[model samples]
Target: MKSLRLIFCALWTAAFVSGCGAYSFTGKSTLSSDVKTFTIRDITLSAPSSYATISQEMTEKLKEYYQRNTKLKLVPQNGDISIEGSIVDYRTDGVAASSGGDKAAMNRLTIVIEVVFTNKFNEEDNFEKDFSFYLDYPQNQTLQEAEKTLVPKILDQLVLNIFGDTVAKW
Candidate 1:
């Protein structure tokens, strides 16, 4: 009876460990390619000199997201597909304001991007589309800090828009 109990406990522990590895492949919902490799070319930023960091930030985010969510490797060249793009527009509008002042109490920043995705093997898979995102600036914050914060928010939205179209079904 003692030997039987020990064997049963060992079997139970093994089964538990195996079950943990049997997850439901959730990452597949976000990426379509089974190709396991891709490249995102350097995005062009068509803004003032201050906006240069936004380009690098978006590129890094794209690479990081793919690395974290899929089994694919980011290849520098000769990839199965490539995503290239430019920042077409950037604007700031007041969303809320003090009644007596020209300055805004709160502001919203919108960034518009035009992206071209190309599949080297299949022209039919290539796509060119525009996406836009906005971030709100706090009234108490300096314009400089607002500028810094806005880029990440836009990049986050850009990633969501790209991933949804490419992999997630609508």
Candidate 2:
């Protein structure tokens, strides 16, 4: 009976594993097999309000994200896939009003990126789009104080969104 039970458990485990053959924990990428390399041209800052280093920071983060998440190699120019873009908008605005309605209770920092994706293997997948993200902070804090913590978070999400649109096709 013990031997029969062990065999049954083995069969169950195998069945479960086989059923997940198509499942990918990292999420599915629609990139074709022919796409083995990618390039990200230097990101430019068009927003006068944005800091000087923001463009460089964003470009490096994007490259690192793609390298870590995908098997594609990085090339300097004209790879199977290429991305080029500029930061079009970066500004702060009042989001929530105080009880007196004369002042803001919360402030939001927003960033907008204009992206152009080129797919050498699949021209139909090429696209140009704008991706935006924001972070909210209490009105008591200055923009300088909030920016240090919020900018990184916003950039990370922007990169993820760009990745989803270009490769994952989500």
The model with the greatest TM-score is 2
Error of 2 at 14 (Å): 4.8
| Per-residue C-alpha lDDT of model 1 across residues 1-170, encoded as one tens digit per residue | 99999999999999998887634345354344456678888878885543657778888887788677667688997777678888888777788877778778888878887888876666676799998888888878865778876788779888878766554424
Cα-based lDDT for every prediction: 0.75, 0.93
User: Whole-model lDDT for model 2 versus the true structure?
Assistant: 0.93
Write one digit per residue (lDDT tens) for candidate 2, span 3-64.
99999999999999999876655565578889999999999999988766889999999999
- Model 2 off-target regions past 4 Å? 1-23
Candidate 1 residue spans exceeding 4 A from truth = 1-34, 48-50, 101-103, 121-123
Which candidate comes out best when scored by lDDT? 2
TM-score of each: 0.72, 0.87
